[model samples]
Target: MSIEEDRAVQAAQDTVVRETDNGYRVLGSPEESVTHQHDIDRIPQFDVTQEMVSGSGENQEAWLTYGGNYEMHRYTTADVIGPDNVNDLEVEYDISVGSGSSMEGSPVIVPGDPTVMYQSNGPNHIKAIDARNGDVLWSYTYAVPSDVVLCCDDNNRGPAVWQDKVYMTTLDSGVVALNRYTGEEEWYTSTADHERGYSATWAPIVHDGTIYTGSAGGEYGVRGFHTAIDAETGEQKWFTRTCPEEEFVGDSINQAAGTNWMTATYDEERDVLYMPVGNPGPDFDGSVRPGPNRNTCGTLCIDAETGERLWFHQESPHDVWDYDSASPRMLIRDLEFDHRDEVRDTVVNAGKTGWAYSMDAETGQLITRSDPGVQQLNMFSMIPHIDDGRRGTFMPGGMGGCDWHPATYNHETGLVYYKMHNNAQEAWWRFEEFEEGRKYWGGILEDETEAMPDEYNGHISSISAFDPTTGKLVWRDWIDSDTYLWGGTMSTTTGLMFAGTQNGQFIAYDAETGERLWEFDTGDAPLSSSPISWYDPDEGKQYIAIQVGGSGWLRRGKRDDRVVVFSLAE
Candidate 1:
């Protein structure tokens, strides 16, 4: 829609700018869109310590950190709203964020008697909601530049709450800190030059006093790097360049556009950071850069204190297919090995290469590569070495496999649950020079939905249960063969897995078995974001919340920002 059209729509008094389940619609004003809690003081003090954030998802009372508890587990100990009662789940309250974009980030529940929820929208809008009721506590929206270039949508995975402030990365390459007590801007630190195509769409992973975040825009030829900033003062502690010495493809790959866009899980035990780095510049056409790109498509183990490179693992060498290890890496604490008798801890990561790779936590070693999680056709074939420029189609395309959506590990089942895109893309290579702040891909690729291989199902996406210990796929559930499962998954101790679908159904499946136990239609919005569960002891009820509203969760759908939450039907 054009700006004039948007203004004309906004000018309409009857236009529903925001709508909640209780029929709270901002028919007149956009400022009233952010409903603040009247009894804000009754909530609690803005005091979330490092200890509380570290012990997140364990207490079953609050969800303090992303990845649940730094392991990126996305698992909750809360089992109140599980299997049997899951079918009786109904909407608790629904709050609309705005009409800008959908919700891609998880909601963080601050630890308190009556917890408050923090959510991030695609366009850098952060909101605080009263968990007890659906009252909007407060909201802080960062002013993103209209001209700034973003690799994907204007989405932030979520925010990191520590001390007295809430931290979030911006689409305009910014790290903004806001006062947790009242939605006020505390500080804004620039991570990279946004005009040069540098952005930070991932959530800032917060540690003791430092917050670690990465840069986006690998497609724009900007050199990839992650920074450590002081959580309180917004001071950059250290920055690590991906390929400072041209380590991977030697001199052939001069442009170091290996962006570390996702949030890296921290092994607080070893004081090491395991981050997944993305694809290098010019995604296709690896001829310009000869040798296999080393650190680009793999996991990088770094010293948490000093930002020093400890070890690295490259999944797809010379990743011409854009098979980036872009999915967030997780630290599996007690992973029992299938071949080796020893019970060694490993860092598990889902890849776009349609496989799950787990490496030794202390020493980065290929522990196991899970069986194919998605369809793989013409896997790793060279782009027809002909002078004539013609596009070649390939399965497990750029958007194939587990692209970006985080996987949850079930301790009971001992399997990883993640989404898979069985897609085909028509990719062609060309020689294009790196132009600053521009699309520098020496090639181009597009989704080829009309024509796919015979083995390809009619489904656009599916979810898989991968056995990380043995490198095998236990089950692949194509819940809806028609729509995509854009939203990610999260698990509970009750052996129940929670996820949302592109068809607007918030679903629950048996983690051990691929059985669809329950589902709820969340209207026209696509539930592209993952569902998070936290037990509220005050209400004596468990709540499951998800932000549903995004067009390009892979396919364009109705765009509405609604934070729909659920609990057992009273």
Candidate 2:
């Protein structure tokens, strides 16, 4: 079939597949054929070496790592568009990449070629686009598995590029490497069995010659682990289970689940990888799973080369609140701690428990924890009347203190900016028989007879800037919306902070004062992915790009997927 004809057929097939209940299925096998429409040899080739990614933010060229750099700072040094003229920023171009349930993946631009970029959609659909004008260069659709069970929506974070290949993890528990130039598959490796509830949704981080990733099935009673695979050959180097054998509460290690569902940060100088591990299985009731749950709900510092654990610090021990330390742990250097009266190197993490923790990079020691970033009522309150069906309300519910959204840090001001939702969620418990390969939440948060509780009303969402070293709030601005602030924040050398709201607006704030500076409506399509910035080498212009469409809470808004790029008006 012709290229256009194939796309038409694929679109029809996608429509039918999306309408199915749950909208995701397991593929027969990894050897299944995928429809391709572009010539592999004819595509342009470019080098995305480790050196390029290491020093990516130093230049005005690319946004390499998922967090813009190995430090996971999410701060870009591009200064072409400053606060003085940011109001002049206007939409440059917008292109839709078909509709999906959610658009959480951030796009990565090729180094020195601002016009070419790559991104993934909700269903693990990968696309290579011309960043100059949002034109599709090539596309690859991953085969969905028919039997996979996903607690959340079908979401793929993004991809990592190294040398000549781009790597992405699929929802079907596999990782596939594609040629950087073309969208053709170079190699596909199964990371876990989807039938056992092991899946991957975060972007893989590549360093040296290895690609590092973690699995996501903390709610399905599957044992979680972090793996390092040979980037070029797709061979397993080493695997470290997030749950240590000694800490297993049950007879089998499978009862412990400490999934690493977020992208990790690397300290190249120290050769340490800081990965945030998710919550344990049987999410609500922890009775079945005993022990301290050592490695789960914590940050694990591993030797990147050997995948050996260097140190770990649990954020929530024996957690019954479902708090997962799954947000990006940002590495900050040479910060003066006013409380300690010394300068120190630290890794900071904003956790779902509503506190920001700063720890020593050399040894996993808690330096300080900031005040609660959100409302914190009924925290750690055990569920009462498991069989009586009595309802309980808790603040900073399962959604987050700061779930999955990447926070931004500013070196000049020594402040980290992150968003928080202050909605009180209803919690209740019931005795449900344990079933393998399925969601094992022992209780339900939202029971029948109430679409949503009246107590959930008047929800407040705010973004706060806090000093990680001293654990003090610098400034904060409350967003006038009831929904969660799902998009990640980005800081610029221009002294501005950018974040998107579920209410279809991209808003900017003054980095120092938290003053609202600018706002642009995104045509009612909620911006769920983090915003990134880059300079167009050909045009000598700087632009901020973000994926818009689909809401954060289970893709509640419009599903029109589009990458919207903005720049100063010419």
The candidate that wins on lDDT is 2
Model 2 clashing residue pairs (backbone):
25-145, 25-146, 26-145, 26-146, 26-147, 27-145, 115-131
For candidate 1, give the lDDT. 0.76
Model 2: per-residue Cα lDDT over 31-72, one tens digit each: 343535553443457677778999986756788889989998
The deviation in Å at residue 151 for candidate 1 is 2.2
Residue 373 lDDT (model 1): 80
Worst 10 residues of 1 by lDDT: 20-29
lDDT of each: 0.76, 0.77
TM-score for each candidate, following the candidate numbering: 0.91, 0.93
